[model samples]
Target: MQTIANTTSDFIRVSSEIGTLRRLLIHSPDRGLGKVVPSKAQDWLFEDIVNLDMMRRDEYDFYVKLLLYFLDPDKIKGRVANLAPGTDRGFFKPDHPDYFASEKVIDIQCLLSDILADEVIRTKLIAAICGIERTSFKTQQQLTSVDPVELAKILISGSLPDRTMLFAPLPNFIFTRDIGIVINDHILLNKPAKQARTREALLAQYIFFNHSLFADYRDKIIEIPDNEHAFLLPDSDTARDLSRSTLEGGDVMMIGPRHLLIGCSERTTLYAAQQVMRLVFDKGVVDTVTIIKIPKKRDYMHIDTVFTQVKRNVWVLLGTLARTGDEARKQDVMHFFAPKDLSEDLKILQFRKGQEQKPIEIENLEDLLANISRNDLGATEPVTFIYSGNNEFPFGAREQWTDSCNLLALKDGVVVGYDRNDYTAEAFRQAGFDVVTAAEVLDRFERGESSPEAIENTFIMLPSAELSRARGGSHCMSLPLLREGF
Candidate 1:
């Protein structure tokens, strides 16, 4: 709604998982959580009903504090300046105060205010919601009479003037990662699998389109079409039918500059993965896409939930999924291919619907890496995999269910995750990462006792007793916009 000149300077630039984080977009749990009743928790895509007050008091506030400390612009610049001689700290000043403000972190509520600030944006948004045209004077008057700030809150909290209209609160909106993803210099707006989450995606879409910070990147936003509308479209009459495709950001990962890894699991469909690959390639965004098909189950709802990169070539994976055929029980399969590899023959042979496609013939994680290297480069990069719970059985399963492997990388080797997963924390400690609590890091930061340069390969652990009840971790809550390239 905010019409500003598009510029490349405002675009997102994320290419790898371990890059130094610059800007992040997050949504704190709000009144939406109050609507999630015990009788309708599953309908809202929650594993169980949660206590809204406890979630806000014990979980979200602490998580925001940790994120603010790690992403502080001054600290990030200091770290870069320390690492690279002659680097200018002034160059690291972010475009928006929300990104650099140490005392204030930007939340969805703040974003909505920006969206409604512009008269044109407000009118268009209102028209879209009411299924009317912006040209209507009566509608314009009605929109103008409502205070922008109050309207923004009402829209987000789902407190419609007419209570008869069915409105479901977006409880899962706290998990920002599932709404959208930023690839190298581009934004991919996701179409969620559940209807309750569609509004979340729409809000994100509006924010990206109208937000002043993202004005220049408007053309770069790619909207994934909703699959439910497939029946409305005429049959493609082609070999590939992507109409019914669906993609969630939680299942898509940008592992490296030239490569993207997508999960065809419980939430993302194989058709959607193929479509994303084609779109990225056609736009010259990425060179290759690797599809990892994990078993369709709630536990393995997303790839990030089970695996994430910790360093340049090091990763953390769920113990069970990292194993081979006999040990893994056919739960994990890695599918790799390039844009050029897609042909009518290849499509018909590999991606035919309703038939179980042969899994990528790899014995284990090592074999999968070998395959990736063979196709993407001449030699395989040495990869060190630290499994959750040190590959120990019952403990591993237990910790993983609590999001032990769902770590968010702040820099090359530094990451953040749940403190409740003691086994995974112990594993990170044994791996030489300084396992520290969020309180310790925040205290040092507030007291000026430490800087980003003082901490390397450190895992800042946050209290997750209440947050984990939502079935997500740090990776699920934060969506990175910009990060320093490797």
Candidate 2:
């Protein structure tokens, strides 16, 4: 890992969703993404197999450039003008000497490499990974001899330097948010619900515990313990569902210093949600924990896919999924009298730390988010919402599927999103926010026409032609480690 001499403070806390993000964890698209075959795409949580080169050069590189410009301007300010726009990917590669190795924007692969350099950690991690992948002992032995940098790449990409595959690639590792979440200076590691993501959890746990950067906050790391007799549980669906203690970072949000929101979606089980509520409450990390349960379906994989905070009082979401009761069920003349789909119902329950006897029930997503803005963050302005695809028919659902609701806030009113969500961008423009493309923003920054501090209430759009196919947005790509508190 690279160091920043100017970075002195050891900050690692998140109080609000829309705070100015100073540090985050990200993984650039590696060879593993290109290995995701169509046969196992859905099994690995990908909507479709992506054109890896396009995803790297055309789409995700813009995201990296945008983040660097806003968070660590010195690393990319004037240098971008010299590189070939679409073809120069070496600037983003961590191992490449020319790569923008910003300490502020840390990459997980580099952290893995840093830890793997230790002989003991390397042995233990290799054993652990082999145990999980069931690779032959010879394969494990072969990995131990590889250089730390190459080993780290192979571990994540699951491919050797010569393109030999020893095990399945961790394609979903790009979505760093699923591995763990930081809540008020405490890291809450995830217990993933899916089997395909087991390696990701293991790697993240090792990084948090073994990395020098996280050494200061080791005691603050909160890991969800599996349910009693969880190991002995049968393989049947009913049996596993009864005690599966799974929680994903996507379903978690440290919305306020004293408030945490968890969603019980397809990726996060309610068993894990209840466990987190008790855990955070007992730790005194938060006074309140809210569980927002949405339909357990692929379309709404996590709460973030449905809504994310843009500002203290402003939020963007899929209105189709945020409404409740009659409002959610659109009433046309023919379907007015038909039975409502109970599965679409959105449920909310709030648990106070010491007041567990009287849990509060919130009616719907809008009311819950609005309450957080007012009560938790002390926003006095009227809570406003920008809907997916401008809340139009079919477009809302279409855009939401492409992660229109998923956005990462750079500061209070500025966020990063995909350029493909044209209607959502228009909605932001309509709402009096400046919407600019990532390439254009970088150009402006390079020309000294714009700077991060002066940029406010702006939507920094990224090229996402290939990224959208991976079924994640910028929010999913980032794991905020430190942010300015509200």
Candidate 3:
């Protein structure tokens, strides 16, 4: 239980969801959106056709604004107040000052700038891109001569002049949580389920490996060897065979210090989960690994989209999974809803350094969770569950589809989510959380009207008119590197 202050390295460490966020990794929806056409939207993993301009202006702009505000409230507030009068501040606190501060918001581009500042890293990146593109020597020379910043943009956004689609637009790269998860003191780079997102994993790996921010824990990074091989040698037979083991960050949840819950959902495979457990055990990262087998459906793609911990004891969960209905009991699609027969669905693996792996069965998710809290957390408090749509059918289905369950906790009892899910918002309100808009929270903080500490059970809602269409919530869009200890 090391606190963020006591922790020696700044690379990676996350124990619980409801800890104060310290650092994050996010990607802006830029060139990725440019590559997504209507005919190839489904293949590119987009739910519906999207206008690139709208995504950039309406969705990504606000998303970045909200994140920057959370990361540095005072700086962002001051910057916004200084902006020109007619400028669309988006969700910033309205009209306090009209000055312009030229500081750029921290995003993937900023991180890439930092990474490319190093000559060694810049050279390696250029060579890698050239190798991937199979470009000619003259083209490689031209890329080497170009400025690092422009080269980074080319690497991420792609280059039409060179006719090299080195890294195709990573449309889904906006969901940073799907690329990596921090556990204990290390980073576990995820292997995405689709080829469209493979470049994102490479980009993350390059950052953790080359960027000075993560230099302290370069060796501490953990990733499936199969994924590494696939990224480096996509055409190799070895890489192809090893690619069968797949795991995405969206499926992983670090519930406690030594308790990790991973879901075998549409994106993660059972073999991948087993492999991850072996690596964690070898590294002495956790004592137990609980695999929650969720339904393999588009709507239920990841566990976080269906279940998320909002408070110490309270969880916002999909209503349908919490209880068995007459229709479910009568049918036998996956038997995942058999509340009485938990052993059939839940799987727990116990591991130690030199011992063989042991499997344990449980009756249901509740019992499994209760045991985890008791054994791992050493707490006897009863766990509480809040339904997404208050046990309503179509409403619950609708809200879940819009990622009502996928809330990102800034700290205990403080979370950020989309405001479109009214039913879910009401549920949180009834649970003692004040549903405040991002603008309201920022305005109050800037005016010295209130501090985050002064607020209790607050649910900050982000404007997600276009973001919601991307089919990811706040949690999906962020990769938290550091969070204050709970």
Give the Cα-based TM-score of candidate 1 against the true structure: 0.78
lDDT per residue (tens digit) for residues 179-243 in model 2: 99999989999988888889999999999998878878899999997788777767785354677
Residue by residue across 1-486, what tens digits does model 1's lDDT show? Answer: 112222446437888777888777777776667667778888888877777666665556556656666666453332322112122222211223433333223566667766787788887776665442123556446656676666665566665455321356777887888888999988998878776676676678788887877777788888765466667777772123445677888898876777787887678887788778767877878865677777666877888888887777567877666552233322221122222211111111122122224423344544554444344333345656777776665666678888887888888788889889888888888888889877677667656788665778788887777788889888988888878875
Candidate 1 error regions (>4 Å):
1-11, 73-105, 130-144, 160-166, 226-229, 232-243, 324-363, 369-382
In Å, residue 365's CA in model 1 sits off its true spot by 3.7
The candidate that wins on lDDT is: 2
Each prediction's Cα lDDT score?
0.68, 0.85, 0.70
| Model 1 lDDT at residue 105 | 39
Q: What lDDT tens digits, residue by residue, belong to model 3 across residues 1-486?
A: 000121344546788777777667666665556666678778778887666666665445555655566665555665444222224565321111321111223355556666776788888877876676577777777777766556666777666434456445667877889888999788898988777676677777787777666767778898885554545555564334445677898899887887788888788887788789889988988877778887667888998998887777677877666543435432332343343432243344444444544466554565665565556555556766666775455676688888899998877778888888888889887877799877677677668787766776888887676778788998998888777764
TM-score of each: 0.78, 0.95, 0.82
Ranking by lDDT: 2, 3, 1
Report the error of model 2 at residue 323, Å.
3.0
Pitting candidate 1 against candidate 2, the one with the higher lDDT is 2
State the lDDT at 30 in candidate 2: 92
Extract clashing residue pairs from model 1: 7-216
> Between 1 and 3, whose TM-score is larger?
3
